[model samples]
Target: MFSPALLQMILVAALLSLLSAGKLTASDYYVATTGNDQNPGTLNQPFRTVARGISSARQPGDNVIVRKGIYPQARTLNLANPGTADNYISLKAFEEEEVIIDGSNLQKDATLIAVLSHHIRIQGLTVRNSQNIGISIWGPGTRVHAVEVSGNRVHHCQNSGIYAGFNRLHDPVRDLLIEDNVISECSLMNEGGRYNQWSFGAGAGLSRKVTIRNNTVSHCYGEGIGLYLSNKGTIEGNTVHDNFSVNIYLDNTTNTRVSRNLVYSTEDQRFYRFNHPASGIQIANENYQGFNNPSSHNVITNNILIGNYIAISSGSYQRGGGLKHTLIANNTAWGSIGPLLHIDADTSHYKSRISNNIFKQTGNVPLTDIQGSTARIEFSNNLWHGGVPQQSARSTSDLEADPQLINGGSFNPEAYRLSESSPAHNAGIKLPEVEQDFNGKPRSKNFDIGAW
Candidate 1:
C-alpha cells in the first residue's frame, strides 16, 4: 500500500479533478427579469424566470439566487429537487436584493411556492397575491423533512401565508424551522368562499419537531398561527395580533410548547368582527375526520396577552378528543372583554394545571368561566384582580389583589412587566419547566407570579 501522505495527496488530486470536471461541486444559478432563459444561469447571463433558475439547481448545496425584480408566475413554482442531510439546496434573494414572487397571474387554488422535497432552505423572498397559500412546504403521499423557511415576507395570500402539512397521518412532515418571517393580510378569500373561513397567517399540521418562532403574524382571517395534529412543536416569541379568530391556536396537538409570545387584539377589533371572537390563545381538539388526536401534554407560559375576548382557553370543539395534562403558567393577561379563561363544557378528559398567571380584567367579566368538570384541574398561586365574582375559591393559595404591574392597564407588552415593589414579585410557586421569564430573563429561585 502507498504511504499515508501519498494516499492523501492522491485523494486530493482526485477530488480536484472531479471538481474541475464539474462533478462534485455545488452550483449557483441566477435569475433576473431582464435576462433570458436561453442564457447560462450566471451573474452576467442569468435566467429570466425563477423556474429556470430553480430547475438548473439540481444538486446538493446548489443555490438559486434571484435578483431584485418582480417575477409573476402563472403557475406554481414547484421546488421538487432535494438536497442531502449534510447539504441544503437554497432559493433566496440575491445578497439582500428584493425578490418578489407575485402569483397574481397564477390559476386559482395554486400556491406561489410549493416545496415538495426535503432539505430545502427558502429565505429572504417576498411572496404575495397568491390565490391559495403563499408558501406551501408539503409532500402529497410522501414525507418532507429538514426544511427552513426564514426571513420571508408573505402577504395578501387568499389562503394561509405559509403552510406545511400532509393529509396522510403516517406521512407526516417533519423538522421544519420557520422563523423571522412577517406574515400578514392572508386568508383574504375566506370571506364566504369555498374555503369556509378556515385560512390563517401561518400554520403547520401533521408535522413533528417543528420550531416556529420570532414571526410577526397579523390581520388574518382565521388563527394567526396554528398547529394542528402536530406534536413536539415549539411556538415561541411570535408577535401575533388582530386575527379574526384565535391569535395562536393549538388544535389536536401534543407535547407542544407555546411560550413567550405576545398575542393581542386591537381595541377596535379590526379583523375580529368577521367570524370568531378575538382570542389570545386557544388549545382544543377539533377532531377532524379520520384524525382523533387530542391536545395534551402541552405547556403555555411566559406569554403576554392584551385586549382579547379570551386570553387563554381549552376545549373540545368536536366533543371527541379533549385537552389533558396542560400547564398554563407565568402568563400576563389584561383587558379581556369576556372571561380571561374559558373551558368548554364538553371537554372530555379535562385535566390541567394553572399557576403563576396574572388574570386582570377591566370590567365585571369573570376571570374564568369553566363549564366543564373542574375536579381534575389544579389552580394555585395565581394573582387575580378587577373581575366581579372572582373564582378564587378553586385555589387556596391564589391571591386576590392588584398585581401592581408597570402601566398594567396599557396595551403595550412591556407595560405588563412587574415593578420592583409589585406584589407579584417573587410570589409564585416554582415551576421546573419554566426557567425563564417572558423577556428571556432567567428566573431566580424565588419565582415571580406573572410574566415579567
Candidate 2:
C-alpha cells in the first residue's frame, strides 16, 4: 500500500535499473582474416577487417574480438566510440590467440592505432612496424579517461611505441593504465638529420592518475619510459634497459613514485657520437615551450641500477624549473662509468633527501658528483663501497665497507641481493615510503640498505 507519488518513484527507479542492466549486457563481434565485411560479425560469419569489427561494437560492454592472424592495414585503426565508466568497450585478441596489427603499408607519419575516446580497453594484440607511433591515445579537443592499454607487444616503430598526451593545461587526460606490455626497438627514425628527439618506447604526458607497471621496455632510441608533465603517477615494477637516452625519465612530473624498477644499460659507446651515454634514471625539468613546471615531491625507491653512465641524475642544464623535495631511498646502484649519483648545480635551493641507498662503483669513478649547492640536501645511513669517497663528509652514519653482494658482477637482480653477513643488512634508517623491497617483498622493521 503506497501513495501515488511513491509508486511513481519506485516505477522510475525500476526502469532505470533495467536500462543499466541492458547496458551491461554485452555483444561479441568477431573479425577474421578470411571473412567478409558484409557478414554479421558472428563466430561463423565474421567481419574481414578490424575496422568493421570496431564499427560493429557500438554499445557499452561490447567486445571486438579479432582472431588469430596478421591484419595489415593502410589506414589507422581508430577507436572513437565512447563507453561508460562501468562497461568498457574492449578490443582484444580472441581466446589468447595471436593477433598482429601491421602498419607496414601505411605512410611514414601515420599512426597504427589511435584511441580517441574514453573508457576503452585494448589488450593482447601485437602492434608493430608503424613509421610513426604504434599506439597513440590522444585527443586535442576532448579529455580522454579510463583507457587501459595492456598485454600488448609493440616494436619496430619509427617513433614512439605507445604515447598518450594532451596539450591543454587544464584539460589533461586522466586515469590511464599501461601495464604488462613489451615495447622495444622503438624510435627507430632517430638519426642525425631526421631524428625524432621527442620519441620514447612508452610515454605519457599531460595526464593525471596514471599507472605504468610491470612492463619490459628496451632498446629504444630515446627514453625507455618517459613521463612528462604528468602528476600523481606510479611507475613501478618495470624493467627498462639499453635505451639511447635515459632509461626512466621524469620531466616536470610531480608527486610520482618510481619504485621497484630495474634500469640498466650494457652499451659501452654512446648511441649517437654527439649524444651523451645513457643514464639509469633522469629527473629533470625540460621546460618545453616555457611551461616552467618543477619536477617536485617525487619518490624514487627500491630500484636496481647497473652499468649506466650515471645511475641517478637530478637537475637539468636546460634552465627551466628545478628539482625540489625529492626522496631517493633504498636503492642499489652498481658498476657505473661515471658517478653513481650526480646532483647538478641547478638544484641549489631544493631540499632533497638521499638515504638508505647502496652506492658502489669500481675504478677511480666517484660515488657521487655533487657539483652545486648541498646545504639543503640530506644524506644519511648509506652503505658506500669501492669508489672515490665523495659522500663521506655529507653523511655521518654512512658506512665504507663491502656490501658483499651475492654475485656483484652479474646483471641479474638476485646478484645484487645482500649476502647473509653483508654490511648492508639492517643498515638503513626507517623511511615510511619504502614498505616493500625490489621484488615486492615486505620490508622488515629493520630495513635493509639496498634493493633486495
How much RMSD separates candidate 1 from the native structure? 4.2
lDDT of each: 0.86, 0.86
Segments of candidate 1 deviating more than 4 angstroms: 1-22, 140-142, 192-197, 268-270, 273-277, 388-393
Residue 391 CA displacement from its true place in model 2, Å: 4.7
Query: For model 2, how does the per-residue alpha-carbon lDDT over 321-383 read when each residue is reduced to its tens digit?
Result: 445788999999998878898877763447778899999997688888877667777889988
Per-residue accuracy of model 1 over 147-166 as CA lDDT, tens digit each: 99999999999999999998
Root-mean-square deviation of every model: 4.2, 3.9
Clashing pairs in 1: none
> After best superposition, candidate 1 residue 176: deviation in angstroms?
0.3
Cα lDDT for residue 325, model 1? 86
Q: How does model 1 score by TM-score?
A: 0.92
